[model samples]
Target chain A: MEFKKYSKTLFFGATLAVLAGCGGNDAVTQDDVNASTDGQVQPVITSDGSNGDSAVNGEQLGQEAQNLQDQASSAIAALPEVETVYFDFDTSVIRDDSREVLDLHVAYLNANPAQNVVLEGHADERGTREYNNALGERRGNAVKNYFMVQGVSADRIEVISYGEEKPAVIGHNNAAWSKNRRVEIKY
Target chain B: MPFKKWIKAAAFTLLCVTQQAVADLTIEITQGNDRATPVAVVPFAWLGQSPLPEDVAQIVSDDLERSGLIRPLSRSDMLSLPSQKSEIYFRDWSLLKQDYLLIGQVRPSVSPGVLTIQFELYDVVRQTRVLGEVISGKVSELRSRAHYISDKVFEHLTGIEGAFSTRLAYVTMRKDEAGQNKYELKVADADGRREKSILTTYKPILSPSWSPDAQHLAYVSFETGRPGIFIQNVYSGKRRQLTAFKGLNGAPSWSPDGEKLAVVLSKDGNPELYVIDLNTYKMKRLTKHYAIDTEPEWSPDGERIMFTSSRSGGPQIYQLDLVSGETERLTFEGNYNARARFSPDGTEIYFVHQKDGIFHIAAQELANNRLRILTQTPLDESPSVSPNGSMLIYATQEGSRGYLGAVSVNGQIRYRLPSQRADVREPAWSPFLTN
Candidate 1:
């Protein structure tokens, strides 16, 4: 079941790439790749003017764009999803499941130094508002400390906690609460 | 003279027995001298294109009435429905026996999609404007602004600040199609309106406690498959994990001073209370009992603590002197009593008590050793007294769902605030706001 879930995620990612290529405007943002690559990086700038052999240049531009897209897709496929970190009720301690996810996150941070990531901490609805805020912060710091220990630069990671104010699920049951108490990695 | 002495002695003996019976029966008068004040809230008038917002006046009426301190007069019975101060006729309100009048108008502001709400409060007897304020927000905030105005009028007349601007945090649970349960942490206005979910999960979330500053929350989350305490900030969305011990880490209580937190952890085998300093991140054990000692609450003065323990076989309330480290049993009236909270004045303690096969709220006078049952509910638990000690909020099971309810400290009035969609539990009333 877990292997099927991963394969489905990869398939969905490839479909998203193909859809983006068909769309006319293709402007790559900083989030596209790590900026500090030590190889010969060729900038692919497309001509926006309507005059010079428009179809030919458009085809060439599409080919170059496809090459970058393929690179990004492969990179994403190689990366593991960091959703395994689970927190105990009102606790910030890293559990066994968290260790697996943290290992992937640490590897990603080590490979990309120019990339900055934000760790957002959350809590399930149970306690008072202020206490949950503190609890969320503690969870974020726990992840940050783990990455620092794994040779990632502490300055590259930021932590924030949204305590019981933003829930992923609206249901008021155990299933929803479990999903709400999580830490997300945003790059 | 001998015959007269004999008659006096017999009468005195009879009086003593009657007093003893009254003490044993425990009839508590929860109501105070201040009855729910009567006020008239006229529907808001529309000045421009849009129709007046739906039920703005009704929302304000319900908010005040549910607080058990105000009785909003019906609009149908009003002599005149006024939308502004000039349209109000004090003589008509006075004739209708209404003490106060609220009038408001919603007009289009310079900014598009924004509405300006101008409101006024009039003293019917004095024939003067008691309060007037203008607020600007999106049309969606109209109901919230109305509640704020009602709170102001209540405070102006009663000299006690209303909790209209305060928010309530609670947990809701529901079962899925496969029978797995989902839980969510929700925040809403004190009146149980405008609920927004903060967290949702399959794991159980318990014992959410707010910090004194109202900026942070500490709760127990079981998402990682074990109970641990976590703290999160509301504004910036930051979270920090405080502890992940083996046995248990639950029931976090913030110190009144906001520098430390008191929580229940069982790292040393038995559940006990520990205080963690926020700055240093160091924990100090407060209790060393082999029995379960949990639910620590700091006193208003921050001099001592009160908590629930089973040191004497059955669960009972105990007080710990911070200076002398001496513990004393506080409850002696019932075999099952827990979750004790000190009154804001520190003169009495309120806790859940089970007597005669029924669970209810009991208050003990610290000075006179007098105990009184304040609730008549069958299963009352987690009693949290208001800052003024005039009311207490607790959670109990209604059919199959948990519902939050409030009772006057005197035990005269009782009302339940149940959610229409989900089961609600674990309500913590915020302290009195300064302004």
Candidate 2:
């Protein structure tokens, strides 16, 4: 087997502090492409916005996800080494790279049922603190929902949002904000 | 005794005691009211300690100018120093275009540690004494009394009641000795005097909302692992965590009656609005939408709650009727609007509105739905209206540091309350603080 070094495009230091984590082997796939295509993303709001967006059925999606994971059980083995996932500005929607890291975390969490993990979410300091708190929590909940879909119990995952209060990198520019808006998984 | 105890605890955190008394915030009046009443507040004759511990007249002048409605004559421009009505130089002040004059004498009272303060306001144009008052209080209470004198003088000249007697609660964050960010909850006089630290922690603190009576403060503190809503007495500094649910407990807004607090909690899956009864600890979930409904603020009538909700795909304020269980959209002009609060009279709603990728404090008249952006600066958030509903203080940033800025309700007067070292945000002006 070719042991290719996992690649990443994060401008943040390779020196992220992760709890119960290995060396940065967390494969970041499609992040550079996602960042370049961000200009094409439409504004989330429009007139009569609520009519088109329906509430996500988390439980039903969890069951369907569990069936998919049950069939691909052999492919998942070792826990993912990466512990941090970056998000788009003002959005908690999981990107492709973030989903890849979380999928590996789901494999790690499934292999060890005794293991419990905490998801701490954060946001850039562009918006109001309280709304950012909600945004951060939404990011955490998005990760937690993914874990539950992969057969992890709700109690095993703890979600906390710091809003814009705590920043991994302290600066006002987009470079710092992109790194700041993230979810860090701690085991 | 509680205040004294708090002072003792706060004294060590102070960097320079002398500088803070004179210069804390650099006030820049961006928009001047052409009709602003110009008044000269002559220096008050001090009869207290050898070197007066405080400058009472300067404090009063700062308070008046901070309000944006009054223009204080520069101390140098004063043709002559007058301390009483008998030393009348009305002709000179009139030449300087002063409409009114204020002078006072602060003398030691018969009781030890007490000073009897007297001040007189004269209408220069009318050439008659406008108002006169005498107050006696402990030396430590001199600053608050100076504000009191300004309040009386303000009300006598203008029909509106003065909010100078009020106080402010805000958060200041800076790097501590060990290079870790230290967050402090500080309470100060409206004129930025007697600033004392109520609570100092390494964790982040935000949303300092004062109780209706101004006796307590409810805020979001991250002291214990994660974010939690905490309430602490302003005088005692004793605090208790109101909620520490599993997911999120932030943005605590006290009700009008001071009986319940409207907060954002995410324990029941998504971030929803919840009101917690302060007496019984019972939680009443207000909204159950999958979309984020947070930053709950109660109207003065206590009948409706205005909150920030992304239920419309983006953050826009929505009003919830407490009795009828119905919600109505309040803000339709902006795709991003949050951190909404009410004016004192409940006639207007002030919130941070985003336009052209810049956030400005905007007010919506409840009667006609007229939208008016009240601030000139960018990235302004957390608009806390003054008790009298004249000006609102919000957070703005320059480079990476945050500073507090205030703008009048009419979008005319403006000033920035920037600190020398610390980055300050979340300034909650106290209600009419009656002692």
Candidate 3:
């Protein structure tokens, strides 16, 4: 294992950027094939493996509207408060630690009636994904209910559940799950 | 505690080594491998001047071994290797205690880039040839042709149609150059060969459901910074977005007829079941509940839809009658039984069942409700049954990364298709595919 890592690093000294894309299933280039068999190493892919596996980039296809999200982020950053709330496992009920953050967002929404927020709900990488979506949306709805009870109008808030798909941090332990089961107060 | 920590560390290091050493798909039989029928698959004699791309007989042997019902004898144990009936000595194979013997020879076909494999399967004790055929295809198709032969031999011996000739649709994730998680939707042969990327993005793709026709795949893609259902043609790579609702538009399951999809949409404040017509784009809500109703799948007969709903105070599967609108709760043993799938015959149901906090794939008969856990792995979900209803493939995690695992329907045989680098998930095994 140590020898493989060292060999890979040496071969990819200047091609490290391209090495990442080689992880793709059929996206390996002729250069990657050459590198894999460089030191008389056995070739992995079939000899007839094609090099035409270019993927459809979703960002480039529909980026006319999403390009402004970072600007929206800066606006939220100007508020100087917590913009995320988390939940315990399998439960959507808001916790006490999240109360202060939820209240801060409520106050901001109240002060800026024109500022609309999308509560993007998320869950840890556990359980079935679609069920987690529901689990996630329940958390989002909990936040939406709390915000509305604190005087934010229903029209000013939207909710969506990504379930376990998108993670703020990537890992499979409690440290990551505790942070992943969250609802981001997206602008 | 120290012993447990050491074991965990050892397992982690082993997985890292596996990830580095494996190139494509390496089959791992995890459990219940002791009672398989022992057989022999002699290497096919090759006549080509150049080395062929793949090992044909080894692929056939691997496919049979993956079923966990047939075990191939080691080549070293064979007293003599034979490529034709004239060269075979039945007493030699019987001495090795192999119940069945397979022999084949590959010859370059008259057509350039094509090869013909003539194979024969013999019953050792019976001293007679049971199956024989010749398959010819392009050089790149050697793996698939091997699977076809495996299917034929498996069916003739077991009386069950082999799923080896099918395809698998799955999602793979790896970090791109920018150090961002890039996800890809791909399709490949059942043995994890001939993988073709269908879509790629930095966002996540989930719940890849194959159309009944096996020509298209419907999945939830979060490419636009939001979830939407999209259908892509398997061969052409052309896709069209089916939904762009305000909230969650996920879990697109096709009805038996392939004309409509049972989807979960939160367009109206709460996630609910909706039947969306493919041709007219007409959407009809099927379930109305405030407690998160999602993961709607159509029954094989198309008379009812099974979905997961939290209305019963926990995530459990519920069956909804399409004609009467009456709902019946099917699972009562587990607090979390979701992502339910109907067996092809509609006699049983398979799902993700939580037990002692670890999710495992389970099946329950409809008549007697004899519930049985089919998989032993942890965090197993999205149980996609083979069209033959004999086995299933699901998503499971090892360490921090995910891999696709498979098990026979009876919970006896187990295997996994571990990827070399990608975090593979949501594997939907295609039906018996067309040429």
Candidate 4:
């Protein structure tokens, strides 16, 4: 498990550097590729375990890279365009208005077996910071449990609450706070 | 023509003399009771030494009345307005049921811009002056000087430090012409007077927490297009950005020792509580829960941290001991409880408790595990105890607009300060005044 984790970290570093180098109009500059490899990618690989057998390292790195790519593609394909699920003030119970958005997430999760998503809960600035944080987590868990009941694996869905720390709207009025209390699904 | 010029000068001097006479006089009350100290504030007599810029007597009277502890006997009730304690007759005041009397006069200072206010607080019952002192300040600061005199007199009699000199920091949000939200951080006198905006931004600003020293304020601002923590000095107006991490950087709480700050950061893909050393900017992750862990407030002793975590299947307040690495749940009476703050004595934790579908500020005694609701407001949040732990301030909504409110620690004497300019929220009481 330790070896697998190290290999996966190295693969992620390399892929990030390559992606940075690939964004160009000119024939990929040697400096761009070299900079990506030397300045960015090589450090991460060396830190993970460069003294290990290079052949085994390379094969493991390849397998981890393929798995990450598959996960990325699956996540993209399973993405539901729904941006957020709104809730009433001081409430964690998902409303009818947010039910359609949750349904889309449920369908997306069922269609993509390898994909999992985390729900980020948020609240408006109406209450105290600590109360809003708790309220946010409740909203996130509400969405997570709904997805689990719809046949999505419990292990695939995670819930985290941001509370009133982040708001979609900054208004002090009810209109702003109402829009701010919400849950966003991230894959 | 030369004689006419001298006459014009004489008229100007006469006009100034009357204004000076009206402003130089002041009054001081030396004795009072819990049932509103009744004292007569006589208008000061000008010695005609120099021109005064303000009505010192009225200023002193206003200060005493606003304290809610003293009631200045109306001038209409005064048998006579005497300018000096020697001129006041104890028998006349005794007939009027006045318990005390104040008399003073202002004179020219040695410096050009300064004035010396000599005052005496007299006990009408004893027929003697109980306190006598001369205070000097610039003419421009005459009102503040009067407030200081009131504070001294109140403390001498009541034995409680007067809060007249303190200020309250509150957030005000308003909608602007472009239909966008505007937020302002305002500091006002304890009586909600002399308001001044400390910081104004188009981005949202939340959680304005004052440092223990009262020189700086730490708050969460989205001005950089993300929720980040920024500390700004209230006096110097210099601000330092503490965190702008990629994902989430919100809820910055200062430690009791003022060496570290416990904040919520989500850079590692999940929101968790982390303590950052302000000096080195190094962070030690405190909670590893995949569930959200945020709103970290330090215990008074700095040995433990109280925060909100949803790991127990729902949101609840938990305390984490730094030395033992032990975690204990603190709230179980409600479905949701968060935003806990320790009292000044560290005996109880005050937080927002949601029970019976209404949210209120509730206090839980750590020793007995007893919970008591300290507020009647339906949506009270952000319960911040006073430096002395005598009162708690929080924000609650009335209709659609939010207002800042305060209640005594025993849950009596509740009052709300509703903003006419904008909706108010997130009130942070400053630490006790150093001076």
* Each candidate's DockQ: 0.01, 0.15, 0.11, 0.07
lDDT of each residue in B1-435, candidate 1, tens digit only: 211111111111111111111110111223222466788878777787856544556666665655556767876798777897668878888888888888888889999888888888888888888899888887777656766876787678668667666666677777777877788876665665556667788877777777777677788787776567888774465788787764457778888898988887544433567788788766676776534467788888888888876556456788887777777888888776777788878998888777875678788889986889977756566677665566777876655567777777766555566555576777776665443
RMSD of 3: 17.1
Residue B232's C-alpha lDDT in candidate 2?
A: 97
Native contact share for candidate 1: 0.00
lDDT of 2 by residue, A62-166 (tens): 554665467465756566789999888777766656766877788788878899999999998887999999888777766776676567776688778999998
Best by TM-score: 2
TM-score of chain A considered alone, across all candidate predictions: 0.57, 0.63, 0.58, 0.58
Candidate 1 Cα errors over 4 Å, as ranges: A1-187, B1-35, B52-55, B235-237, B432-435
Give the winner by DockQ. Answer: 2
Q: What is the lDDT of residue A26 in candidate 4?
A: 14
lDDT of 3 by residue, A73-130 (tens): 4433246357888888877767767766766676667667798999988999889999
Q: What is the interface RMSD of candidate 4, in Å?
A: 16.3
**Cα RMSD over interface residues, candidate 2:** 17.1
Q: Positional deviation of A128 in candidate 3, in angstroms?
A: 0.8
TM-score of each: 0.63, 0.85, 0.83, 0.69
Q: After superposing candidate 4 on the true structure, give the runs of residues whose Cα lies further than 4 Å from its correct spot.
A: A1-83, A87-121, A124-127, A133-180, A184-187, B1-67, B72-75, B95-107
Instruction: Write the residue-wise lDDT of candidate 3 on B1-435 in tens digits.
Output: 211111111111111121122345556766545656778999999988997777788888878877877878977788888999999999998888889999999999888899999999999999999899988988777888889999998898788899899999999999888889989998887877667788999888999999988999999999988888999999998899888776778999999999999888766455677887787766676765545678888998899999897765568888998877678889999788999999999999999999988899999999988889877777899999998888899999988789988888887667778888889999998977866
Per-residue alpha-carbon lDDT of candidate 4 for residues B234-347, written as tens digits (9 for 90 to 100): 888899888866445777888988888888765543456777777776677677553457788899899999988665545689999888878789999887788899998789
CAPRI quality level assigned to candidate 2 from its DockQ score: incorrect
Fnat: each model in turn: 0.00, 0.29, 0.25, 0.07
| TM-score, candidate 1, chain B alone | 0.87
